[model samples]
Target: MAWGRIQTADGRTLSGMLTDTGLQPMTGFGSTTPAGPVEALDGATLLAPCQPGKFIGLWNNYHAAAEKNGLAIPAAPLWFLKPDTSVVGHGATVTLPPQAGRVIFEGELGVVIGTPCRNASLAEAEAAIFGYTCINDLTSLDILNADPAFAQWSRAKGFDGFGVIGPSIATGLDWRDLTIRTLVNGRERQSYPASDMIFSPAEIVQHLSQDMTLMPGDVIAVGTSLGVRPVKAGDVVAVEIDGIGSAEVTLA
Candidate 1:
């Protein structure tokens, strides 16, 4: 089943399951508590599948990108955090700040955590996943390298609307079986298989758990492969994963 959140006409947000017929309203996300009446899906505005407490992004996780850039395979995942404020829902418009300089769109798959996890085993990590979502890890390429003393990872990537996530969350997908494709201005820009990853989704979670506690609704972007490029005003960049659906953001 797929889960999503929609904005009501009254300016409130409602979480529910996306059914073929319509949306089956649920009392809360990731729970079997109860449900409300079914609503038509025709014109509802979609929000990011969940409000993530932590927006984590991985770097050099894919072997293809790593080999191309001559980066060494790391013993564990190399990651950075983007503040939750950077998140924008599917179809949202992102105003690229002037200070951002040149920004690039990184299409990647997303893993959404369902339960609290810390020091979890591989088996437990797999069980803790709620579902998957599409991600566009928009980054300020210039700012990232502008500083000589330190890499401004968070500052370069944490601007509002940089962390693009979700049209919906799809459950029961095998990460290895999925492929991520990116389109920029309606042209195919990236296509890669999840099987190219140096670390699998469960392993990513298991490793991260050993370092920090992961909370429900937290998102971990599995990282992008090749074809990451700069996007300017009026450009539409979309990241689509077969099971999870597309998350498109416009630069303005």
Candidate 2:
């Protein structure tokens, strides 16, 4: 099943399940109770699938990319956080801040938490997972490397609209078989298999949970592979994961 949040034509926001016919309104996230009537997709605006309290992004989680860059695999997840304000839904416009010189798009898979977890075991973490979604972790590369003394991972990627995620969150997906593809202005820029990930989604959740409590609606971006490149104003960047669906953002 796929879950999503959307704005109806009447300007009402609803949480619902996405179906071929339309969105069937639900009482709440992960709830089986119906709230309102089914809404047609054509008349509704899709919002970010979930509002995450903590938005985490992993680094160098893919073996292929690690090998290509000659970086050793880490024993644990190397991560960063993106502010909630940086999040935007599918079809949203990402404005390039004046301070940003070169902005790049990273296509990644997002793991959404369903239940609160702290120091969870692997089995517990697996059970706590809600689903997966697509994410475009936009970065201001220029700002990232500006100061040699420190790598500003958070500041470099936490600009408004930089944490792009969701058309829907897909449950029961075989994430290992999924592939993440990125396109810039209709041309394919990245195509990588999730099998290349050095740390699987479940392992990431278990390990990270040991560090901090992961609440419901928290999201973890499973990092990107090679082929990430800069995008300019007017460019439309799309991140697609077969079962999870695609999220497109236009640069402004």
Candidate 3:
């Protein structure tokens, strides 16, 4: 099953269907059966799939990309956090805020938390998962790697619309065997298999739970591989993971 949050023509927001066919309202994101009203897709627009309390992301998780950047494979998973407001929905335009310089696009696999968990073991972590989705973790690289006095990831990556997720969340996709890709202007800039991940999704969750509580709706971006590239205004950025679907956004 797929889950999404959409906007209605009347400006009302609610969770619903997210497919090429269009939006369909349901009781909630956790609704099991798809027996809901066939509200006009135009009645609502898509919103970021979930309103997460914590948005955790990973770095150096992909082996190929780490090697390309002349970096060693991490001894352990490196994780970071982006502000909740960074999220935007599919088909939304990402405004390159004036303060940002040298913005880049990172296509990644996103894991959505289904239940609350803390200090979970690998076995327990496996049960905490809810689903998966696509992530376009747009970054302001200059600001991200700036001076030692001001190198704060929260400011560099927390800009509104900097984190783009959706089309929809796949509830039962096998994450270990997916192709993650990023395309800019019809050109394939990045492509790697999920097998390239240095750490498994369950490991990421288990590690994260040691330090923070994983709550329902919290997202863990599995990190990107070597295909990260710069983008400018008017360019279209797309991230697709086979079986999960694609998420496209325009730079504005």
Kindly report which residue stretches of model 1 are placed more than 4 angstroms away from their true locations once superposed. Answer: none
TM-score of each: 0.97, 0.98, 0.93
lDDT of 3 at 59: 89
Winner on lDDT between 1 and 2 is 2
lDDT (C-alpha) at residue 3 in model 2: 95
- Residues 11-52 of candidate 2 have per-residue lDDT tens digits of 988887999768888887877799888889888899999999
Model 3 residue 246 CA deviation (Å) reads: 1.4
Q: Please report how far candidate 1 places residue 119 from its true position, in Å.
A: 0.7
**Candidate 1 residue lDDT tens string, 1-252:** 898888866676778788765677787678755477777766777889899999999999999999999999999999999999999999999999999999999999999999999999999999999999999999998999998999999999999999999988999998889999999989999999999999999999999999999998999999999999999999999999997888998899
Q: Give residue 57's lDDT in candidate 3 (0 to 100).
A: 87
For model 2, the superposed segments whose C-alpha errors exceed 4 Å read none
What is the RMSD, in Å, between candidate 1 and the native fold over all Cα? 1.1
Give candidate 2's whole-model lDDT.
0.94
Regions of model 3 farther than 4 Å from truth: 17-26, 33-36
